[model samples]
Target: MTILNNKESMRVTLKSVTVPSIPLAALLVIACSGLWFSSYWGARLALFPNQTTEIVNHLQKIIVPNTLLSEIISFFLTLLNAFLLAQINNKFTIIRTRTFLPILVFMTLMGTWNETHLANGSHISLTLFILSLFSFFSMSRNRNSSEQAFMGSFLISISSILINPLIFLIPVCWIGFGMFQSLSLKTFLASLMGGLTPWILYLALNFIINPHFNVLQALILNPNFVLDISTYSLPDLVYFALMSIIIIMGIVGLYSTAHSDAIDTRNKLNFLVFLLISLCVICFIFINQFVSFLPIIALVYALLFSHPLTLKQNNFHSILFIVFCVINLVYAVSKYILT
Candidate 1:
């Protein structure tokens, strides 16, 4: 019985080691392939947009070309992204447990789907933000120094915008990522260049696809740009409000945690605070699409900070925060195109 159990354990460990590499490569192939389709089709809903929709519509545009170089490149980028995001946990305090992966894969798939599906509505502006949130949660489960944590964040932000340039909004994280990593200026510039490289390619591709590139249109910044918002139903408003309340409480938790005397957790808590502030600014400057991006980041930060707030401490504020998310989600049911 012991020998059989040991054999099973060894097989499981070996398989676990090998499986992530292939699926990770496959995921990036699918994600990058989604971008290729985006170029050809323009981000649009043919008939289905939801993840719950038929798999054919969602996966149809993703073509895994079997070329060696393309596959290798796809594989490497995905590995780097995943490593920056989740590999720290195994490397540091270095747990041998296999539980972290399912959640990681789930988020990767959902996040990629969100990025791809929403490309038309909210993808471009929120690009850096959404990817940063995904990376934050992925790394939240690890043991990393302040510097390592910062670099991980920086690289993720820089890497995210490589696919979508509008992500330049999270410059704070890119800067912080570099600073936290204690990287030399050359390495920092190299990563920054890497981030912008995709956008440069995007322009070249634009020229190839359309000879007379609308240089003026691409460069023009509306001096008085305002978002165009459609009407929202009552339920949509409710859900939006509920989501907001939950977020505020989470931020409050972050503040409480950051001020702690515990030196160990201060830096991470502070990092979360920095992320929240940056996210808030993006929400203000860019678009309201940032609301959904808030809850998860806040929740993850709350977990890291772990400052339990009692109703006695601030009853009214706590109640209001919880109320907001409920109202917001309710509103979203009727008003939102994406759930």
Candidate 2:
């Protein structure tokens, strides 16, 4: 009771600390340091090949010193993704306080020493994916802006797939989200045209590159699906489990509070977007591309999961929050030391 009575006590929670940039700056230090722990430093782009290898290869040629270049590009792209998610929070009031929890949660996930930082196709794809979400959410308020939002999201999603074909299913999710957001027939047709436009350009490029190139094989059946999580160590598994639980809790908390009149149309629409992305990530988690997909989930996790911490004062919630932070910190430190 005394702790709650204190004015500073509220500021001690995870939700509060994320509101300021200082904590996120410290998190960046810890995250970037952990990135150096592995054999990844100065590692060539596409450490291994995938659907996007050709594009990454072209970048490697133009960029010079593929490893550092990829890292720098991916890192800043990640920052932009984080900032965009924060703006979504601001636009939709996803979190009660305008906090940079999206970035903090992303950095926390990155701290797990996952291969999310390899400056690969996934990063580029996720960068575009975040931009797509930004465009999609802008459709919340203005019907007049829906066409731009629809076209922008479609173009971004198409470009993302050109790099990482595993996310080819995402445009369907986007369309579903658009319909959920009260999309008009005209916007729906516009989305179709927007998604199709990328393939037209891709085929044109392919035609110029190699006349013998098989357009069908190039476009279809390009994604490789690998379902294996056994490579994760015990600590990785533990952290994964805890984070998954937190996400489920966050979604449930948001749903429970959805009926409140205080929440508006835009917030509800944004929540639908969160739910859509979460489902898509779960469906594709078995693939190698899943690592890049984690940050998107992290953004949703921070938005939905922070609700309980902000609303509840119980000991269990407090303990859970502490454990979430500690688990990440310890896993990151141990991974850095052991590796």
Candidate 3:
């Protein structure tokens, strides 16, 4: 009985720390800023692909990697993403409570990954993807969802111009619209039109600029399906394995307690789960080609993971959260300081 009481007290203490408050938010900002600075300094440890798509190549020519301007842009974009994440949770109540834990988790994930400290096409694409979610979630049970569908798919189509593999998400978004009961013939046609509009405009612009330009070839998604796990360093492999475990735990926790949420909230959360799974598959298949998608993946993981971490008041979850934070710190130290 005494041991049980002590464990309960510990759980309560940890739960209080996880609560969303102004002081906690400020502290997180300071800590994440420090981490981001360290990551920027250790950017040399990141392994970038030698060759990339023509669009990304063009983007790099403008952004110019390893520059202070690029790092500053990336940092501000991360902050913007954190703000958007908090807004998404507050607007939709996806976590069933008003909390900033998603922002905390997301910033921690972003700061730990050295590769994300540089401005890239993936950063821009992720911002667009999250914006699309705002439109997509608003379409739940909305009778006139054609406009939202168009806007959402239009944003995603623009994102695909940067990260070509993201084009596959259009079908996933359509399936999500079906789950939300907002998929009608009109909305379907609108989404289809929205998905094609960007490509059409890009093709036309390219034709006007250079009639011989091969826009179709530029749009092709050439994913390297080979799983080259052996290429990763020991620390990277361990870090990735830990992240995979956290993802599995979050998914299991979500399904275990999903019945408690409101129907609307549940449907929205289900769409997130479906979208997260689809993104994971895309990442797995195209990891070599599109590692920039990590920030987007981290965004979804933070949302799903926060649900159970913030709500579950058990000692097991509290301990898990503590371990999660410690692991992130250690990984950051290993990459940025030790290396």
Candidate 4:
């Protein structure tokens, strides 16, 4: 446990073990730890079926099970998202130090899912968003991969939109990234085509079955935003407070290094942080209108928050890091006991 006190040791622990996905295994164990609180764990599935397309609605029904299997599958999906996120960070040298973003993501998730949870369509779209980001990032310095990257990014974005119509704003961010990467017209066109392809096929099938079904109307009129966070209880507020503090610390850490890092690295990381915060803003203000998008923010927060731990910035970061962990874990345990 002393590794928790040192940055280098923590980095090695995450980076050295990937073959068997030790980080993911550890996350699973932590997620399953909620079983002890199962009595208090209510069904907290956040699904907006009316806003979703038929394809995603069917998926929602099938993906959500009342049994323990749903939790296992949800955790697995979360791990996949974390792994993909870590891959992006490593490939682009975002954090530089080889730290596991998944662990950070899991810890943030613990605050949300301790009492009740579900791997809803919103969570599923998050994974798709990560895949789209992976494709977008893969095109960073490789011109030859532009078409594939753009196509994949668009395809995933479109799919995610179908699942959670609220994510329709994300493609704009992708377009911004495409511009930042200096994408070619062909690549841009390819992305547009890729996004349209799903709709084309879906409409074609729908027309054959139901002549009155209008894809355009479906696209234009689906999402109904429900904006209310007042229902959040005391425990929820405490969890949010802890998460916010961590994110603030992470932002401070990243800001401190902005001018010191290499230009290209700083620019890329800044763009990513900007895009993540943009998405979070959108999620909070419009789309999700809830803390459901904390996982997405958690991924970005983990990356930035991790920067402070990579260097020996006095013992302040170490103290803060340990304190944060202890608070969250203690909160989880105490919540379970009291419930």
Give the distance in Å from residue 58's predicted Cα in candidate 4 to where it truly belongs: 1.8
lDDT of 1 by residue, 1-339 (tens): 011145334211222312346676566446545433332243322222222211222333452223333234333433444443344333321122322332333233323332233322222223334354444333432334333334434544443332222354346544444334433554445446644555566567777988998645543322222555454444545544654555566556546534543332444445556666675665545353343333234333333322322211243433443443234333323322442
Candidate 4 structure, TM-score to reference:
0.75
lDDT of 3 at 61: 86
Minimal lDDT window, size 10, model 4 = 11-20
For candidate 3, the lDDT comes to 0.81
Q: TM-score for every candidate vs. truth? A: 0.45, 0.76, 0.92, 0.75
- How many angstroms is residue 256 displaced in model 3 relative to the true structure, after the best TM-score fit? 2.8
Clashes of each: 22, 0, 0, 0
Candidate 4: regions farther than 4 A off: 1-52, 107-111, 114-117, 141-145, 169-187, 220-229, 287-292, 330-339
Give lDDT tens digits, candidate 3, residues 1-339: 012355335333345456646777698798898888776665544655433566778878888777777778888888998998989888988998876678888998988876876646777888899999999999998757899999999999998887788889999999999899898999999999999999899889888999899877886677777888787778888888998898788778877788998888889888888888898898878877646678888898899988887777676666667778889988887765446
- Candidate achieving higher lDDT, 3 or 4: 3
On lDDT, the stronger of 1 and 2 is 2
Off by over 4 Å in 2: 1-12, 21-53, 60-66, 141-146, 166-171, 174-180, 222-226, 261-286, 310-315, 334-338
- lDDT, candidate 2, residue 100? 52
| Per-model C-alpha RMSD | 12.9, 4.5, 2.8, 5.2
Q: Which lDDT values do the candidates have, in the order given?
A: 0.39, 0.57, 0.81, 0.58
Candidate 1 vs candidate 3: the TM-score winner is 3
Instruction: Show model 1 residue runs off by greater than 4 Å.
Output: 1-165, 178-184, 208-210, 219-230, 233-238, 257-265, 288-339
